[model samples]
Target: MLKIEDLHVAVDGAEILKGLTLEVPAGEVHAIMGPNGSGKSTLSHTIAGRDAYEVLSGGVTLDGDNLLALDPNERAAKGLFLSFQHPIEIPGVQTMNFIRTAMNAQRKARSEEEISAADFLKSIRAKAKLVGLNDAKIKRPFNVGFSGGEKKRMEMLQLVMFEPRFAIMDETDSGLDIDALKMVGDVVNELRDPSRGFLVITHYQRLLDYIKPDAVHVLADGRIVKSGGPELAAELERSGYDQFIEAA
Candidate 1:
């Protein structure tokens, strides 16, 4: 399980996540929705152990491990993955080489053997097809010359290839069309299992229509004010965040 107990975080000496607490158990997907500046990104970054976000108080744990104590790479090696809101472009690095290096680094951290080139190529090819990326795209530099939607697809590609125990997808649907949205849902659904969990952060209810979450939480002013089932997403879509914004 991934648990956050009264998580208090600050960025640039200003508090963003205030007394935020939540839990996502294994085998379920949870969605977080909020207006601008509600600390949605902060929560994800804090859990992922980003250095700029300072944890003033409270705790975050995966299963039983103290996540806050680990560095970002340590957290990743522990099966924590965060799909960034803006995927970066690495100009000089080869896509396959970067991924393989990262995969091996994580494995090495866990005392596991590295993947062979043949096996890695086979796996990447299969997952690339699943994420709707052709061989040519995979061969290109990471996120170089790709559109916004394609960048999101690249994120999904890593999500599937890594198969982390818990994933935080931060606004992955921002620039995707219906087809890309469905492809995102397809990859997520295929990876959903009893031992894994997801925290999907999105603005629109359309993505929820594709991958229905077990629970949805409303975040406002750095705290979760209300939580409900999948129906809450539709309600939010209709009512909007005006009421919640005032409440915050």
Candidate 2:
């Protein structure tokens, strides 16, 4: 389970996540909906242990392991993945090489044998197809010269390939079209299992139409102001976040 207990975080001396608390139990997918600057990305980055997102107080734990103490790479080795809202472009790194290196590094940290070249090739090709990415795209530099939708596809490809125990998708639906959104849902649903968990941070209800989160949370002023079943997303869509924002 991923649990947050009164987490207060600051970035560059300004607090973004203030006394936020939430839990994503294993086998569940939870969605977070909030207006801009509500600390949705802040929560994700803090969980992933990014630099300068200082944890002023509170705690975050994954299956009883204190996540606050671990570095970002250590967290990745422990099966935590964060799909960035804006996938950056690496000018010179080959896509396949970078992913393979990262996969092997995580395996090495876990004391597992590295995947052989042939096996890695086969797996990446299969997952690329699954996420609507083609062989040509995968052969290019990572996210370089790719459209926003293509970058999102690359993120989904990694999600499917890594099969992380817990995933925090920060507004992955931001720049995607209907087809790309459905592809994201398809990859997530295929990976859904009794042992994996997802924290999907999104602004729209359409993405939820495909993924169907078990719970929907309303975040305002860096805190979860309201939480409900999947229907809450629709309610938020109809009513908007004004009420929740005021309440918060």
Candidate 3:
């Protein structure tokens, strides 16, 4: 559902992603593993249309539509969801209000009806519990005073609530305990459908154990250098990224 071709991105005039090309078809999960400075986050941010991540060349598209031409909110309305590696806190924003507003905004953008308050409350509560978040936690301000794992759980809550067509999970497993990892996996697995796709960006293979990927790709020096079956993640865990770093 997501296609990126020869994507060269620069941050502050320094090139990071050099000729990176990858694709995650509908109904498949693709995991990208690479060491630090391999442009993993850059690729994610660029695809999400984050500011300052300048796309020097190449193209990114969602289901054949040019994504680079659209703003980030537009992409979200198109059913593209990005689970941030570092989910930020908006101190003044009420968690429920923020999420409901976003959900309705996307729906409105797509010419759909807004979710009623009663329905949204019921859905969010169920999804929050599924993601290991309590009612008190969701009642708090957007991620205010939440632990890292809790924040990740909050991300999953949004994921299941939004039910996006394509998801880019950027290190959702970072700082997560085993239970949190399993929760992340459960949410993704539950949301998986023939019409949905996932691009999982992670530095370690532990998360892969919980969420079985259809393909594993090795990213080095801002480009995807190698790709294989799930065994590729196992191999990387055994061998480390030294070989890929040197090869790049």
TM-score of 3: 0.99
**After superposition on all CA atoms, what RMSD does each candidate show versus the true structure?**
0.6, 0.6, 0.6
Q: Which ten residues in a row have the lowest lDDT in candidate 3?
A: 131-140
- For model 3, the stretches where C-alpha displacement exceeds 4 angstroms are none
Per-residue lDDT, model 2, residue 85, is 97
Model 2 agreement with the true structure over 1-248: per-residue lDDT tens digits: 99999999999999988899999999999999999999999999999999979999999999999999999999999999999999999989989999999999999999999999999999999989988889999999999999999999999988887889999999999988999999999889999999999999999899999999999999999999999999999999899999988898
Q: List the residue pairs that clash in candidate 2.
A: none
* Residue 88 shift from truth in candidate 3, angstroms: 0.7
lDDT of 3 by residue, 74-142 (tens): 999999999999999999888999999999999999999999999999999998999989999888899
lDDT of 3 at 243: 98
Candidate 1 residue 11 Cα shift, in angstroms, is 0.6
Which residues of candidate 2, in runs, are more than 4 Å off? none
- Candidates' TM-scores? 0.99, 0.99, 0.99
Q: Which lDDT tens digits does candidate 1 get at residues 19-114?
A: 999999999999999998999999999999888999999999999999999999999999999999999999988899999999999999999999
lDDT of 3 at 109: 97
Task: Indicate the TM-score of model 2.
Answer: 0.99
Question: What's the candidate order when arranged by decreasing lDDT?
Answer: 1, 3, 2
